[model samples]
Target: MVTVKLLKPYYIKTDEQTVRVVLAYQYFTLLINQRVFQFIPIEEKEIRVSRENGKIENIHDRFAFQNGKTVIYMSLVELISAPNFLNHLHSIAQPYIQSEETKSVTLKEETEQIIKVLEERNLKRMIDQALDERNKVLFDQLVKLL
Candidate 1:
């Protein structure tokens, strides 16, 4: 399940009139750690038009991170429908899409490496917690002795 955290909502004045702009940041940290996809961190910008009177205008921008750098991997302007938006996403992610090339030693192959790193980090956290518990127990024993 993807969880979307809404940062804020505001209005932007455009050429015609004021349009509602919803700003949000979505991170699939858990899913990425689970090795679901290629796990490229993305910066997504979405603009939703008013349905009551104004016509819907689709504007989206996505930035993909690679080698500690960000690149504008995808962009769509004046997208009229949701399906179009999905199509745009597919086009942007086409390079990493499942194929023989992806199976080979490519950037897609690095996905497993990233997942392993995430798993190791999680293990470290678990070890830290165990150490903290053991320290607490030792402290309690010392207090009893006193």
Candidate 2:
């Protein structure tokens, strides 16, 4: 089983058609078995969402992210079926979805606060697991993200 968590939303960019949200820092993490894969986009971490309902679209079904030398390709279709993903996405996108601005600067502080809180929580959880398993390298790396 895989568990998915969406950690942050950078900001929302509303256009005539596409609404882009540049998820900042380590945007999300995918946990498979006891191992965690934290996704930090070096280039593009694109998620196409429906402007109508805010649910993630299937058009761009696959996304790739790198950690050290390992590159992982994840499917949005799989994520959409993941437990609690829709709810998390809805919560992150709700305010921006309702906003009328092309790009909302108003949520900067709020977004940062959300990111910090989530990042710390995520790191702490992973850190504890690492510590319990005596995985020093993974613990050290996760701590650096803090």
Candidate 3:
């Protein structure tokens, strides 16, 4: 049987890097030297999150550093984990996640507002799938709850 896994938020740490977000799941953003790096799933790099006190030594990255691309050791200046970051990631990721017809115009807005919109869209997709599958219990329950 195919064991499908549900997507959920994750925090992971590697010996070389501390990746807080995984692309195509939630969001990934890295700010280095006043530059912002957003991770998209298509990059196929399989970005992983690292725990606190992680190090980036020996990780070869081309566009992340100003002095050079290949980084040996580095330090983080500041970190922001508010929903606004998530919204920013969502805005950047939406085009890749959704088709043109369903894509919404990007706007500078609050994080809470954007999260609500995303959640609603996800719910609609689930309900639609349940309805299409013709599962009596799931469809009926979701239809009533929704």
Candidate 4:
């Protein structure tokens, strides 16, 4: 069994259109088989939640965290289903969440983000292929896109 808990005071960084919620390390943790685990920050783990509906933009995504060099995957969907998850989210993230009147995201910004994610995914795929083929030159070129 797994359990989720939001530890306060949550860490939040906000730019113009989105809030970056830092969960790895301190703000969040996982409990499995009665043992507690601390999340390792993988991929700089920038999670974006929509200001419009309070839903994670990548709600279907699963992120990998490390436990003593062993990798564990957890889903955003599973975490949100925890008891009182919304109440906890509201309580912890309320200070940063904007009012309904001002919470709208422009289509342009959303489209741009989608494009960025797609490009990054492509770069990662190419990078992996380069490594698999032992093509250091191509790998270097792809990494520079990061």
Candidate 5:
């Protein structure tokens, strides 16, 4: 499964010679038995602008899956049009992004740990089977020699 989120709005120049507004968004993709599924995990958070100072903010999140791999991302927009854009962005991202003061674990780290455990288990099984076969062959040879 792959997840993606829009960390910020992506502005693209269109053929019409105009800049298009794309909502910062996040999505996720899942693959099972050669089938692929895509979904948007985060709903459209309202874009808020503060009148006190020029600042604008929006949050978009998404995920993606390709070639049996999954990725997640968060989309955030902070325009200087509003005074509190930075503060709002920080407040929203705080739960997802780790701070130096907080001991937070990542999804990649957890996946790696699980993979290491499984690999070790498989390797031990292979070694045991090989040793068993070798012992059987040695015993047969000894019997023949006797």
Candidate 6:
């Protein structure tokens, strides 16, 4: 069973709108639903949900998991549809959870490795672009983190 939990919630404001984004710390295991894992949302593919009359509704008609092969996605839906969903989610998410006392530790080292790989890909792209533009200032700033 996989356990999913929100790490923290934050807001980003673009010129057009302010949006809320939630990041789950243990996101890599979610890929069991299939498809490549991505830290960033694809353009025109973000799910928008809102609270209405004390219930959450999808603001848009897009289905978040139209072609996903993972079981947790359905488990998540079941969790949202019924009152007892937390228990169901708990069962699936238990393994992925860390002790509250040791919040800094990740339950699965592999998930951390996958996150590093994804971050490395983005960093490599930025590094390449910086080199092409001859921007040593930005390249040095990025490489230090890498």
Q: Which has the greatest lDDT?
A: 2
- Which of candidates 3 and 6 is the stronger one according to lDDT? 6
Predicted candidate 2 versus true structure: per-residue lDDT over 1-146, tens digit per residue: 66775556676677644556565557777675646767766545666566645656554556665556777777767767768766777776676464535245547767989999998898899999999999999999998887
| Residue 48, model 4, lDDT | 68
Score each candidate by Cα lDDT: 0.40, 0.68, 0.40, 0.67, 0.40, 0.41
Could you give candidate 1's per-residue lDDT for residues 1-146 as a string of tens digits? 32111223332333333243433233211122222221243464444453223333445654232323423243334222323433333333333234455446667569889988887776666556656788776555544443
Per-candidate clashes, comma-separated: 0, 0, 8, 0, 29, 4
The C-alpha RMSD in Å for every predicted model, in order, reads 21.8, 24.8, 19.5, 19.9, 20.1, 19.8
Q: In candidate 1, how many clashes are counted?
A: 0
Candidate 4 residue-wise lDDT at 126: 92
Model 4 residue runs over 4 Å out of place are: 6-10, 101-146
Clashing residue pairs, candidate 1?
none
lDDT of 4 by residue, 1-146 (tens): 66654443346777766666766675666676666665666744546665545656766767565557667877768766765645665666566667765544555578889999999898899999999999999999989988
lDDT for 132 in candidate 4 is 100
Candidate 5 per-residue lDDT, tens place, 1-146, comes to: 22222234333222222222333323222333445544333454333433222233333432232333553333343132224535544444334333444433456677889999997776666656656778776555444443
Find the 10 residues in a row with the least total lDDT in model 2.
Answer: 96-105
TM-score of 3: 0.24
Model 6, residue 37: displacement in angstroms?
57
Which portions of model 3 show Cα errors greater than 4 Å? 1-109
In candidate 5, stretches whose alpha carbon ends up further than 4 angstroms from where it belongs are 1-45, 48-80, 97-108, 134-146
Worst 10 residues of 6 by lDDT: 47-56
- Give candidate 3's error at residue 9 in angstroms: 52
Question: Distance (Å) between predicted and true CA of 58, model 6?
Answer: 46
User: Weakest 10 consecutive residues, lDDT, candidate 1?
Assistant: 28-37
